[model samples]
Target: MKLHVCLSALLAVMASGQGVQAATPDAYRDLNHNGRRDVYEDAGQSIDARVDDLVRQMTLEEKVGAMMHGSLPAGDELGHGGAIYDLDQVGVMIGERHLNSFITRLVVAPRRLAEQNNEVQRLAEQTRLGIPVTISTDPRNHFQAVLGASTAGGGFSLWPETLGLAATGDADLVRRFGEVAHREYRAVGIQMALSPQADLASEPRWPRVTATFGSDPADVSRMVQAYVEGFQGGTDGVRPDGVATVVKHWVGYGAEPEGFDGHNIYGRVARLDNASFAEHVAAFDGAFAAGVAGVMPTYPILEGVSLDGAPLEPVAAGFNRQLLTDLLRDQKGFKGLVLSDWAITNNCDAACRAPTADHPQTAKDIGMPWGVEGLTQPERFAKGVTAGIDQFGGVNDGAMLLQAVRDGQVPAARLDEAVRRIMTLKFQLGLFDNPYVDPDVAERVVGDPQSRAQADLAQRRAQVVLEDGGRPLTAEGVKTVWLYNVDPEEARRRGWAVASDPAQADLALVRVNAPFERLHPHHFFGARQNEGRLDFRDGDADYEAVKQARAARRSVVAVNLDRPAILTNIRDKTDVLIATFGASDAAVLDVATGQARGEGRLPFELPSSMAAVEAQDPARPDDSAAPLYPRGYGRGAPRN
Candidate 1:
């Protein structure tokens, strides 16, 4: 036994002499339980000094983890976020994975979300680094029909969706909406809004138009700037009361064929063949001008596209140095960190080419190497980092990143640079100074009564009258009716009679969605695929019902245009036709009852037919000739 022990000691010493290094304690010290009074810990140091000190003290694993903003385990909670989650998983993500941030998905109770966030921050604080975990959320303040925002009216202010906001053409109101959303976000311990989707809504059939400002680049730019101003509270940096806006998809996302989303390769592949690149850049320019902190790079899984001469061959802005490092960071003069869209680097599997496949064929949470389907998972990470991106979304593993560094694919200095940017935001946000939130405060501020009233007013203001031939929907005539989109309770509360049967009413009212191919929710979100074209066709159940109702009685119809639906068949069927981007059921009813007049105008063209849709180029903003409803089409105050 003595001989064996000596041999083991000698081997270890030999290994050390061969340059094998053991894990050493980082530069942090805990003398007097106050931690080392390093420059990074000092509140009075320059931002550069603080970032440098923090980078030097972090272990490679910690530095890698700092670059990940993974998804929160929202499965066990209330909403459709993560597939599964519990306290143990949270522990692994923060303590073991060393993650310091998570994207908030799906909706839980307001207080419940706050409590969970508090618990998460507590766990993060207990880690060796004690970095507070930042929480981010997609847009949630609006009542968008599709899976745009995760939550709807979940104990927060409810406003019109972005389309509705655009229809209003009120930049000031958009900014105000931003302010409200930011306050509520902060109240719930959410520090980031992965929104103000600066992508132009030129693709009429695009599924995500519900979340856009509009198709007009100039107009969209103005709103984008306003949104940032509101969310960031006009501060060039993060503030305790402010929220950071991650202007998304970088650029050129809305140009997808028939308006498919970029959650996968096909949707992301359909780019503008000859569209105005300047217009696309204009949107990001607006956001950057507002001093936004970060940009979520666009998914570029295309056949052929070049930026400044470099190709998008590996497929993704996350891996394209020309687009991320050169164009955005160098030429465009953007100085913010670039974050990859969720799982953009995931390795493709059985459903690699069929992202919309059902059941087992659906894509998994494994790496989705869309453009660079040829690269391994570790190589994908290294590629993204080399492209000048600072972080990966929804990626929890830091081991792969460490491996990449060891392999010399990503230099330690490059890793440090990424870590520095991330740490700068955290410190600037004062998360290190104070990460805890008062649930009581969240309750008081979030969904406050005053905020609700503003939301109501905004909702009322955003309804657009597409066709008002005979003033058929005036308040007097809407008293007794069959209502579809309008909330029955709200209509009744307003002294309007609500009829259960369509035939029992004097007038028939219907609410229909912008059309698209229906796929399982799991396929659309969990796998991030299955969204398809936007042309509304004849003979669908809802369309038939609306047609039969119009034949039966004087009818009023409101089509909540999530996208510019193919309106050839339904446009001429109703006596009064209205197009609302997204409003409350009550807000719709308010317009129908003439309690509040819709001041909104159509933000994009409503195509006459699918042929028109197919005939036009995805790059052209408004080339739908003889549109059923042209851009900026709306009737105001009954043409009086």
Candidate 2:
């Protein structure tokens, strides 16, 4: 073990090019320009001692800055396009604000990302304390590219969404995926992952179902545990080379009352009864058992819920002490850092609270203060700190937190406590020794052939064949194919000629997504979110295409089930129905042509009709009356 640690340290030093000799175990960085080594800078000292020493030495301004995890702004005003980092903006955050943690929003290649992250760390090295920046990011190794939920796969190995992983019902596969994602993320210099969302997919119409592990608490628990274990290197806490995983949205975030997300004002509260809410809490047991490094509080205010027979404080989870302190920290014993969801403390202005068609909301207008919208910014910060949040995500205003501390709104001890946790993680991650990563290694390691092969296999296995119609799907009989929403080149690669018209083909290959409606276009995230109506209706483009293909020939349909769709209307229209969650064209083709067998089950039940969807409770799972398909139903059989 000792030799392994030494070798790892040596590799990190060599990769970083920091010139620190691995033979000298007591080596330290002279961050303060002092002749003597500070306790925090000495690599030989214990982590607790280093954290305490660092906390004691930090100024109030620096401590406040440490609690704010802001975004690494883009180079130009159009922040969404380029991967280039705005060094000037980063300098202001690091040099003036004293921040050492940031979430990178740049969507670039692995080498460019690593180089930019190294530049950020270089700026941090010049600081008075030289605390290394711990960079974090949302889930970027999947197909979903929602603005805040997930990012595009880009150069990373693409896998099916978490729901698809749940469909496979293989905890080992989920763990393997985490291991791959960890390697890819660390290759790009990301130290923290804001993912492995433990929230259950209880609500059929919820927009974020693709990111969850499904509605069954037991399945979610198993998947979550495996996910954390894989990402953090083991079942034990974060290892030195491991990327820290923040299992998120603490409790009951999936029970959206009317299929509206908590990001907008229309979905401020998640309606949950006591019994149903317990199931939501139980879903996170896997993450807690794995000793996840961090937890992100949910944005929605959990309504009709309580703890120990007392009603929960009517506030968002970030500001609710009963949930964060009394339950999460006390009863559950989760000793990790608690990061508040983005903009929880930001004010809800006119554009935020209510945007018109003429004045549509954007990123700047996002805020989810919920029950405490009346409080001042400093007061909100104090409330969040008191509620047990160690860091505020998507926030750069350290001044507000500093004011809260100076004015005694937030106690100084709490500030130090938060700092200790943050610093301890940085030390545990070996960031102080060497925060840089080799860009060349990043380019080679990320999206390697082996990882891609594993991910592609997973994508194929995760396809849930809901309706096989007693006919095995095989490529032996198929000659000419008509493709809808499938690439013609993929058909040609499979030794099948592509036919322009479905009537002239031997088989019709059609793919569609589970139905959704954009109900709130005026709100920022709401506009992009897949909200409302999980049923296929007439005139719908995807449904029309499916009907057209079925009318011509035996149509084998593949629907991307981002949400549990009401498939009663289209179930009889096709010969075979397969459900996918972020699968590739090749993967779907492989399953459709019997190149690979879909060894997956339904993560969430398919409601028979929209009536059943509306009549069922949003807080419960698989309770719709006369469901089209029950949870765990698949073509071949269910796996453990």
Model 2 lDDT at residue 568:
85
TM-score of each predicted structure versus truth: 0.89, 0.96
RMSD of 1: 9.5
Collision pairs in model 1: 206-259, 315-371, 346-367, 346-368, 346-369, 347-367, 347-368
Candidate 2 Cα misplacement greater than 4 A, ranges: 1-13, 16-23, 75-79, 638-640
| Each candidate structure's count of clashing pairs | 7, 0
Task: Rate residue 76 of model 2 by lDDT.
Answer: 40
| Model 1 C-alpha lDDT per residue in residues 372-479, reported as the tens digit of each score | 777777888899999888999878777777788888999877888788888888776656545556566677777788889988988888888877766545666445
Output the TM-score of candidate 1: 0.89
Q: In model 2, which range of ten residues has the least summed lDDT?
A: 14-23
